[model samples]
Target: MPHSFALQRSSVHSTAFRRLAWGLLVASWACALVSIGLSLARWAAIGHAMDWGRWLPVTVVPAQAMVAGVVAPATMDTAWRWLGVALECIPGLALLYTVLCVHRICRAFLRGEVFGPEVVRGFRGVGWGFLAMFVASLVYQVGVSALLSWLASGQKAGMVVLGVSSFEMSVVVVGLMMLLLAHVLAEGSRLKAESDAFV
Candidate 1:
């Protein structure tokens, strides 16, 4: 495991953790919407003789494929720019779905529905969503690189890189761990049901 996987009790109080989770859920949705809106706006800007020199700050949410500061190439055509935007939105959409799954899990926790079937399903959803996000990220990275390389074909200063990043690998591992945890939760729920039946 690339990360130190520990389920330590939150140093902050449980109430604080709950509050934070709720805040994160809201913020994640807001960011997802903003990312989509920004992509649409950028797509609209493609053919308007927009100034690519003045780099606009892109709002990047966590787990998104595109990090901040990747400026649009001046020589990039409208079609390629649109393609890049579409690819970049893949991770954003994935992250949004993942975050919503996490939010469902958190809501169950707040309701004291731990070890229930719903929570287990929520965990499974999160695990699958995380894996999907990672896969989409790989596609986004490769596609954007290819798009940029094509755009800069006539230029001597163009650069393109293709490699598996450690961050991406870590996310894959985390997804696996989440799936494992989901299995554990399912088993626990089953055992709890059996015990209740005996009582």
Candidate 2:
């Protein structure tokens, strides 16, 4: 197992990994751009066909509580809309940072850095990036809630603008798992190096 990374760089697996990495890199960036574009579009449509909270989170105070077809009226105030946009974009910013880390890892894999310090760092970066997104999402929840409620236009008393989702929890779980995997891989890589040096 210590010699696992001793495989030839030009092997089939390396070729496949490089190709996949390239594909993932392109796809991730494209998706991020598209998502941002859509968010902006939604922001522009705030007062028109869509409610201000359409793109933003509109949910109940407790995540378990369910409200159907609840629409918070469009707040025409520029400051309120801008505040909502800022809150909504926080999670997106964190996601973009996470994708940036993924890009780094993909690049490393493309260069045949199957196991090394660079790869380790890349994994760690992504792991922490996801955790950052998790936190940002929580902030978005509170901020969006306050923004939507402060306007007090057709908003229910107990209604909330933002609430936690399974997706956010999943991201955190995946982030922690990634970190664990990174730690294990780092130790394994270190051991392999030590064994090779001894040999």
Candidate 3:
């Protein structure tokens, strides 16, 4: 009777773990899509004359696919094509990392094992990395606009418009907010670890 009860409990735990994993996967992909969409919208609003061509969809779809299955490539390049590649890879990497962390957390919880402080620290690091990428992209957009405007009309209005676009500001704000949320999650994880250790 006890053996049967233990088996049933184990099955329940496994089901719970699977549910948690699926939830994490969904959330990660949704966040990735929203972030990438906002970025593309900002670029479209700013670089009106530049042809994004295959770059826009290339950047977004690959990142989404990475969330769904494989990890995207991460080769660095300065060319516009390579820039699209890098954009896809950056979010792919971030989503992969987050998924892994969430998986670990779920497994530990299912096993009644305490998650370590490292998990929290990893979350914070990933968040900060995303923030840095957003800032760098924004700066790049501004710089490109400035150069193009200077070449055309000797005025910085293009750069200013690019810098102050609604989408750009939202991206910056959202990135910062995500970073803050990561820090909070990390602290909470650390607290949980400490509490479990005490018990």
Candidate 4:
């Protein structure tokens, strides 16, 4: 029957899409994991150097003055300043992959596919990823602040600036908490939909 053939084709297409979405998710997570690992290794190397008193504070005054004088006036070298644009693309692409996965999961749930557990697991994984990154960032910032304070004793103005900048650690923590909350909401919605169908 033509109807039966069409149904089989649709099912195959759905399976293929699911496979593609899962592949994207796995690849994205792997990239993030590798990036985090590399970052940790770099941090350890830097910390070891600092511990041996092999670190010297770079005089950023000249660089700051030059930027303020020329870059601020023309704003022409913005593209040049953004040389790390490719590195920045990693996170952007990973987040886009997550969004696509979430959308796919949502669509599956709407079709009564019962992917609730998968969605919950995926959400938890994302939440944990965010939390780990947040904690690592906080640790790095705190260590840097302590080192700077030790190196620049009696520089009250510099210490105050560094202390204020360190408050970004709190922002990271809050952002991770929000990400966890988002996962919870998404999982809860899927659960609710299933429950309503049973009712």
Q: Candidate 1's residue-wise lDDT over 32-104, tens digit each?
A: 7887777566555543454445696343222222343233444546666676678768887788788788878
Candidate 3: where are CA atoms >4 Å away? 1-115, 146-161
Ranked candidates (lDDT, high to low): 2, 1, 3, 4
Q: Which candidate tops TM-score?
A: 2
Model 4 ranges off by over 4 Å: 1-16, 43-114, 128-132, 148-199
RMSD (CA, angstroms), candidate 4? 12.7
The C-alpha local distance difference test score for the whole of candidate 2 amounts to 0.69
Q: How accurate is candidate 1 locally (lDDT)?
A: 0.68
lDDT: worst 10-residue window of model 3: 68-77
lDDT of 3 at 151: 33
lDDT of 2 by residue, 66-160 (tens): 23223344544676567666765887898798788888888878776667787788788889988998898778666655554544445435345
Q: Report the Cα lDDT for candidate 4.
A: 0.45
C-alpha TM-scores of all predictions: 0.68, 0.76, 0.41, 0.37
lDDT of 4 at 86: 33
Total clashes for model 1: 0
lDDT of 3 at 170: 64
Task: List candidate 2 segments past 4 Å from native.
Answer: 1-13, 50-70, 152-162
Winner of 1 and 3 under lDDT = 1
